[model samples]
Each structure stands twice: as structure tokens, then as C-alpha cells.
Target: MSFDYDLFVIGGGSGGVRAARVAAQAGARVALAEESRYGGTCVIRGCVPKKLMVFASEYPGAMADAQAYGWTVHAGGFDWSAFHGKLEAELDRLEGVYRGILSGNNVTTFDARATLADAHTIELSTGERLSARHVLVAAGGHPVRPDIPGAELGIVSDDIFKLDALPRSILIVGGGYIACEFACILNGLGVQVTQYYRGAQILRGFDGEARGLVADEMIRSGVDLHLGTNVLGMARAEGGVRVTPTHGEEKVFGAVMFATGRVPNTAGMGLEAAGVELGRNGEIVVDDYSQSTVPSIYAIGDVTDRVNLTPVAIREGMAFVETVIKGNPTPVDHALIPTAIFTQPEMGTVGLSEEEARDQEPVEVYAASFKPMQQSFAGRDDRVLMKLIVSRETRKVLGCHIVAPGAGEMIQLAGIAVKMGATKEDFDHTVAVHPTMSEEIVTMSAPVRTG
Candidate 1:
């Protein structure tokens, strides 16, 4: 069974890169191909750049808080060009690092796209065909615009980073994390941000009380959010993007961005033609071990539509290498992964939601909501929440959710405890960190309500 290479990885995303690198390190002949940037969506257009924007957006509030703390701090208008220049440079460094990782590990790298020609052969856009013992599809996804007249006029999350300058105003059209995070980002940068979501609330899958508080804070922070509203259509107009909403008068803005959803990047990849099963969204269908129906073909990361997080993708890649390359069968653990949403009042959560836990079994919920000393001393009305969903019978912490400043950091540590199956008594036994918002998680003595 001699092949051109032991592995030909399609799509140089976090997952594919990891698989290629690790497999090569394990003495396999591995090669990877990417059509675009080496770092894929997360490093290039996603969390990395978005987190930088989040940091940039937070400066205004920090300055205001400084003023409230009696420091003579003054701020000026945000210079989008300056920040964007640095952002691009940092991304370039990261992309180069990813490239180095592949080459350093002795994995042949291709700057062109690759597709499955068969269970064992890969066709490249560079007019080269190669065969491999295994093929890994890690091609990520692209943000999609809603179907409507003049939809083309609306940009996507990818376009945000490429903007020459920040728009004076933006009409964001989705309630997902991307839309809401950008709404907060652009609003903080002094953009007249108006968001429309046809849903009843933003952050639909999160805890109800947490999302409700976030919605309240978003409104208080001046995002013109219109729930149960959608854009009927969009067209270029005098100001920027003329949008006709499902429920309101037509208005114009400097730009309209759609963050509705993303479709997997398996189109025209010859997956199904080669007898690879695909889901409704064109994602490659894979088993727990990331093996496709065609045993020689495998998929991971967003292309497989699994966990879809960069860390999860990396884990899937590691598991694939363990199973196939090392000859040790391994399955990815998809449970209890923690996530953070960079909204105005950030969200950090792990495990099941209160609503979800309630549906499964009897649970006790311990929660605290109050203004922290820092924000309170600044005279801001902002408040934070800490909550735990505990199983009534097993006494295990079923879920932990936090909505506050640095909730992401808090949740990462809290997630460790939850992942270890810590119970309420375990948390209760822990002492509180005095004067800190997270201390509430430990200090809450009684369940606010038990189901």
C-alpha cells in the first residue's frame, strides 16, 4: 500500500496542522494544503483578531472608570487605522509561526487547496495530484449572508478586519456571539451600532437569567438592539447600507454586516463524489474517531462540524493522530467544554444550562447577582452574576455560569472543578477570595431554589 505520502491533510487549520505536525513527528510522511492563510479562521479572522478588538473596545470604559476614580485621564477618538495595522502585523507573525510548525516537523506544506480525488488520492488546485494512506479534511467555514434581495451588499465578519476604516455606524444582523460581540466592539469604538435579531433575546443558548442581564446591559450601554426583528432586505443608499427591517422603517448606515451562521467548507471538495458521507450543511460525516464512512478518509474541526472550537479542533487532531498514527484508538471527549462570549458583559459557561439540567433531573441552583466593588466605586450601574447548577441526587456540579468582567478567566478555573465532578459541598468547603466578584461562587451557602 505505497502512497505519495502517509497522510495528505486538506485545509491547514488548527486541526489539520496539528494532525500533520504530530503525525510527521511520529515518523509518518505527512503533507498539508491550505487555500488561504495558514492559521485558518480562528487565528486569522476569528478569535485572535476579535479579541484584540475587544481589548481596543474596552479602553474607553477603562478611561471613564479612571476618571471616576479621580484620575485626570482624557481619551480621544479611536484611530481604527493605527490599531488595524498592528493587528495585521500580529496575525502575520502567527501565520508564519503556523507555517514554521509544519515545515519544522518535516510535513510538506502546500499553499494551494486540496480535495479528495478518491479514498487515497488528493487533487490539488496547483495542478498536482497525490495519493496518501489517509486524508484529513480540516477545511474550516465561512460566514454566510442571509438570503434576501441585495444580500450581497451586506458584508460578513470576515470583511470587518479588512475595512479601511471603521464605519460611522453599523447595522448588525444576527443575535449570535459574533453579532453581539461586534455590536459591543463597534459601539465602544463610537460607531452608532444598531443590532437586529428575530429571536426573543440575544445569546439564545446561554442561561436565561445571564442572557437577560446581558441584554439589559447591552441596552444600558447603548446598543440599539431590536429583538424579534430582522432585515427584510438591504441596498446601498445615501449614507451607507439602506436596510428594510421586518418590523421598522427603512434606515441607512455606514455598513450592514451579517453574522447569521457559517457553512462548512466541503463544497466541490469531491467528498461525496468519492463516497464520503456529508451532512445537510455539506460537513463531512465522521465517526467518534473522526473516520469517515470511507475508512481512508477522515475529517476534523469545523469541516466535521464537531465541537468547532479551536481548542476542540486541536484535541480532535491529537486524538486522530493517536488513533491512526500511534495505533492507539482514541475518541475525542466533547463533554463539558467551557466557552466565553466577549459581549459587553462577558459570558463564561461550562456544562449544561440550568434549563437543560432541569429538564434532565432534579437540580439545585445557587446564584448571586450584585455590583462588584470596582464598577460600583466607579458609580456605574453595571452588575455581575455567578451561578452553579448542582444535581440534587448526585450532588455534582452540573453547570457553572458567570457574567461579569473577566468571566472568561473565572470560568476557566471553575471549569476545571466542574470537569473534575466537584459537588456543591466541594465548592462550599472552599474559602472565598475577599472583595472579588468570583468569591460569590464559593460563599453562596444555600441553593436559591431546589428543583
Candidate 2:
């Protein structure tokens, strides 16, 4: 078949960009289209910017720690204008790099939205039609506000990156990592943060102990977290927003933000019209190799609604390229993927949660929670948690969960051991790193409880 390109990729997010770049480098003619920014969610509005905010928010506490450690430190108020400018500049640089990667690999780029016109064709927002032997969709996803009265007056996570200034006080809605992370971030930035979750607890699917510690730390750090509560409605007030909680009196705040949830960005993309099967959530359904119902069409990343992380998407993209272009027929592995949530105390987990592990088979849990040397010396009441879930029969470590300052960094190395099927005996055999919080992971010889 005579086609304009061998591959036509829709969406310039991490997955789509990686696929396009690699396929083009492998000597296949490829083209990609992005409606908005090149770096997509992660670099533009998500992990990248949010991490920077996390860093910014920690300085206040760091300065206090410095004073306690005998170093004279004085910190001033946060200047949102200055930080926001630098953040935008960094995003611009990253977008340029993504564009460079695609163009450098000889993958044609279009700064317009692309949709499936047919099994082997794409229609761009610019009224241009292109045909390809194969098409890949990786449009990512977007945060959605619930259907509530005055919901329009509230902002989503994306709007956080574009704010002119940080509010003096803000109400964050939702109980997921996004809600908890932002609540901590804003609280650290000296905002009077109030968070409301309809659920009994925040971070519902994570390790219960880990999330419990996080919630406690959040409350200690001055976040007015309200459990079993929700915003019945919101309206504009003289100062900012007037929120009426389901169980509390109405209150006014500088702003209200909803971190509710995200949906796949598949609407109006012409996927269903082109015979692509979609889930009830509007995500494109794909086989193990990311091939859609239509032979020539494929979807990956958030649009597939499978493991919606950037690294996972990149892995899926590489697998797609291997299967279609290299004829290797690789399937992306979705199991045992490590994840980190940047909450106040932070959380790093891999394998299974305590609840999940217990449900499967006989398991033993070894956990330790204590005030770390660093925070203890700094006169901070913060504590760290290290937990390991072991299979009773095989003695293999089923999961590793850490809740502390460097939990994210620690989990990466621990994840390797768990991924390699390291046993509890193997961890106990290793020498502990003294004067470190992570040493607890290796030193715990006996299970705290077995079930």
C-alpha cells in the first residue's frame, strides 16, 4: 500500500515521542502530531513541575533544620512569581529537547491535534489528512472535575502550574496521591491548606501502615485533613471560594482545587468511528502487544488505561516498536513495577501491599517505625517506616514499602531486590548501613506478625 509514512503517531507524550523517535531511527518513515506542548503531562504540568514545587516547599523545613543543627539560617516568604517564571522556562527547555529528539531522528512533527480517520489514516486539526501503514495513539490523559455545582469555579491539577500566584489558603479535594501531595506541597509553602476526602482514609490502595503514617505526618505538619467529608458545593466569595462541606459549616478560602481523578484523552479522536473498541472509561482497548481491534491501529500509555505511569508508558512504547518494527513480538511486563508517591513524608512501594499479600497466601510482615536520627536531632517529631512482606512458604520477599524522607530513592534499590526474587534471608544476610534509616530494612530478622 502506498502510504505517506510507515508510522503515524498521535500525541507527543512520553510514549508517543519515544515510539516515533525509535521507529524513525530504525529506518522507518514516521510522523507525529501534538495538539499542545511537546513534553506532555509529565514534563509540562505533572512530575517535573510538581517535583520542583516539592523542592521549593521543603526549603522552609530545611532552613529550620539548619538552625537546629547549629547553622545560622534565615528563610523568607516564598515568592511564587519568581518560582513560576523559572518553572515555565524549564518546561520550555524540556519541550524543545523533546522536539529535537523527534526531528533529530527524522520523524516529521506537526503542531496540531491528530485523530484516526481510518484504520490506516490520520486527520489533523489543521484539516490535513495523512495515511500510514500503521498508526499509534498515545494521547495521555487529563484531570477531570466531578459534576458538582460550582465545579467550574474550582481548578484542576493542571491549573496549579499556571497560577499567577499561590493562594494564602486553599482547599484541596480528593484522597489520592495527587490530592495528598499537593496538600503537603501547599502547606509547606505556607498556605493554610485544608483537605477533604470522602473516604475513610487517603491513599486508599497503598500500604495501609504507610498511608497511615503519611496522614499522621500531614496532620502534624499543619494540614487540616478532614476524613469522611466532602464538599457539597462551592461558590465564589469575596475573598476566593465559599465551600460547604457535607459535615462541616461553610468556610471561605483563597482557592479550591480538585485532584479528583484523570480520564483518558480519547474523546473526539475518531477512534470508535474507525472501529477501535473503547472501554467504558473511554480508554482504547489493546491486546498484549498494544494492537487495537483494527489491525493497523495501536494505543499505549494512559490512553490504554493500563499502568498510567510515564516509565510504564515508555516501556510499552519500546515494546510496541519491537513488536511491529523489529518483529520481536515483545509484550510489556506490567507486574512488579515500583512506584513512589511524593506525599509529605513520601512513599516508595513495590510488589504487593500488606493487604494484597495477605489475601493471596500465608504471609509474614516485618515492619519498623521510629524517629530517624536526622529528624530527631532536628527536634522534629517526624518518623520513618520500613516494612517487608515475606511469603511464609518460600521466604521470598513479596513486597517492600518505605515511608520516609528518601523513601523514593531507597525504594529504587529495594525494588531491584524484590524484582530479582530476593528472599528474606538474603536481606538479613546483608550488613546494615549504620546511622541510616534504610538500615532497618536489612536488620529486621523476625516478623512482627504472621498470618
Candidate 3:
């Protein structure tokens, strides 16, 4: 009746660590396996390192803006090698912290990859086998490379942070957040940056107006955006890489980066041996409670194709412990999860877009667009846009989206309100915060309902 462990978790990323720690805290014996550093993509490459570069890239603008405030600087320069050094040091410190947290919780850590040997057993790369009452896989995902004629000439997200030296010019492919954000960062860092997206606009899934405004702003800030262009392939050329698109001119750059998409890292994990179902994208198929086809098995986070954000993964992991281990029967509510993109001007949103609202309910859209107050003094031409979508019948707020400085910080409050079913009237009734970018949400002018 006693199992080798209470829970065996594969992949010590956000979700796996959270699940292991929570289960262990609840007095369950837990074992966790990770092949690489504990913090996974967010802490190592995808989010954390990318945002750090974004932060570093913004200083030039900040220094320029400081001049308007009567600040003077003699000399300024950016050294890519120095930035890389700091980034690596910080990442190493973080990896140690992740390892400490797991070990401190008494969750046994195995520095090896794991494959499902059977329904109840996991075979480790070290030739060790472990059995548990339940098995949880949160293996996460990896960036994908498209099959082009000379695709190997280009790099993906995994290689972006590892660049030895910054390129003089870079060509970024795809319209996702990674492409958009990196384009802004490199452009701000004085690199001649060109971005290519097959769609008419960047940020395909965002609100139309917001997407348009972001693309326009990025272009104004010196990003050459080539929209509706298909990349044919890439090849090594005279000075660097030559990228040829289907409908556009051939562009040459010091480096090429493809931020196309990511697929779950479920291959060779022996899911078939365990009888677990998988989606077409290779994501683990799980029900509402994150339980796989086999009740004794569970999956969470990007591996499960749920919300791929780190916070959502952590929530799902904790929820799993509460439901499966503690018998509390917790189910995750995925609706209205707030997300932020750390591009130049930044953006944040929760709930549904106006287009999505129309598919579900009659929506009353309220929107406000204006130059931020800082622009009044700093003389910057950029503007901030905020929109609120409300249900016509119920008057409940259906969505909130914004583009500006502090958009991410502001959206969290709105996310909490939306999660609690706050109505349009409730937002209007709330007093506006004075002289703040966020006040625009509560004080938006009444919009004409097209429906």
C-alpha cells in the first residue's frame, strides 16, 4: 500500500516545482526530476532574460527623457559583453534559488530526464526507476524552427540570450510577442532592426486598434516592420545571413532570429507507455482538474496547453495539490487571465477582446485614446490607449485592455475586478485615481454601441 513516493513530478519548471513543493508541504512524499537548471524557460531564457534586455534597452530613452527634466550626462555607452555578463550572473543566482526552494521543502530532486516506463513507474536517465501513487508531467515547451531551404542558418529564442556580441543589424521573423519585444529592444539598443510578420499587423490575436497602435509606435521608434511578407528561407551571405521572403525584397542582416512558435516537449517521454492522451500539438491532454486520461497521471502548464504564463502554471500546480492530494476538489478558472507583453511601450489585457465579446454577448465598448501626461512635459509624441468592453445586457465588464507605461501593473487591478464579475457601473462609480495613466480605465468616455 505504501508507494515509492506520493507524487512523482517530471520537469522542475514553474508548474512542476510548485506541485512538488505544495504536495511535500502537505505531508506527501514527493520526487522531482529536471534535466537542466531548475527555473526553466521563463527564468532562464524566455521571459526573465528577455525582460532584462528590454530593461537595459530602455535606458537610452530614459536618459534622453531625463534631459527634459534638466539632467545632464557627459558620456554614455552600451557594452553588450557587460550586459551578457550581468545576465549570466543573475541567472546563475536564480537557478540556485530554485534548487534551494525545492530541497528546502524536502522534495527529492533528481538531476536527470524522466520517461514514463509504464502506468505507475518512471525511468530516469540515470537508470533508476521510481513509482508513485500519482505521476505529474509539466515538461513545458521549446521554440520551433520552420522547415526552410536553409533554416539551420538562423537561430531561435533559445539562442537569442546566448549571443556573444550584439549584431549591428538583425532580422526578426514572426509577429508574436517575442518578435515584437526583441525588435523593440534591439532597435532601442542602436541596432538596425527589421521585423517581418506574415499577417497584416503584428500581435495577431490582440485587439485591432491596440495592435495597430503598437505597430505604429514601434515603427515610429525606428523598427522597420515588414507585414504580410512570407519568409522563403535563409542562407549565409557575404557579411551575414540573407533572408528572402516570398513577396518582399531580400534582406541581409548580421543575424536572423525566428520567433515563430513553440511546441510542447512531449516527444520521447514515453507517454504511450503510460496510456496518456496527447493533443495534435503534442500537449498533454488533461481534463478540467488537470488529470490525464489515466486518473493517476496529471499534467499542467505549457505541457498541457493550458495558459502558458508562469503565474497560471503556478496556480494550476497549487490547484492540483489541493484537488488530488488534499481532497478539496479544486478546479482552475482559466477565464480572464491577465497577460502582459514587455515591448517598447508595453501592453496588458484581461478577459476577452471586443471581437471575442461579440461572439459571446452583446458588448458595449468604451474607449479612450490620448497622449500620456508625461508627453506634455517630455514632448514625446507617443499616446496611450485604453479600452473597456462591457456586456450590454448584464452591464458586467467583459474585458479590459490597455497600451501604455504601467499597463501591466494597472491591468492586474482590473483583472481582479473582472474576475469578481464587476459591472460597467461599478467601474464608473469607483473614483478615478488622480493624475495617473490608470485612471483612464474608470473615466473612459461613454462609447457609442454599434450593436
Residues 1-451, model 1: lDDT tens digits: 7899998998887888999999999999999999999999999999999999999999999999999999998788999999999999999999999999998999999899888788999988989999999898899998998889999999999999999998888999999899999999999999999999999999998898888888899989999999999988888898788899988799999999999999999899998889999999888889999999999988899988877799999999999999999999999899999999999889999999899999999999999999989989999999899999999999999999999999999999999999999999999899988989999999998889988
lDDT of 3 by residue, 1-451 (tens): 6679999999988888989998999999999999987998889887899888988999888887788778995546789999999999999999999999999999999999999988789999999999999999989999988888888888898898899988899989999998999999999888999898988889988887787889999999999999998689888999899888987588789998889999998999999667999999999999889999988999998998878899998999999999989999999879889999888788888988888889987788998878988765888898888998898899998889899977888888889999999998899999999989889888875775635
Q: How many clashes show up in model 1?
A: 0
- The best-first sequence of candidates by lDDT reads 2, 1, 3
lDDT of 2 by residue, 214-247 (tens): 9999999999999999988888899999999999
Point out where model 2 deviates above 4 Å: none
Ten-residue region with minimum lDDT total, candidate 3: 442-451
lDDT of each: 0.93, 0.94, 0.89
Top model by lDDT, which number?
A: 2
lDDT for model 3 comes to 0.89
Tell me the deviation in Å of residue 148 in model 2: 0.7
RMSD of 1: 0.8
What's the residue-level lDDT of 359 in candidate 3?
Answer: 90
- Of 1 and 3, the candidate ranking higher by lDDT: 1
TM-score of predicted structure 2:
0.99
TM-score of each model, in listed order: 0.99, 0.99, 0.98
Task: Mark the regions of model 1 whose C-alpha exceeds 4 Å error after superposition.
Answer: none
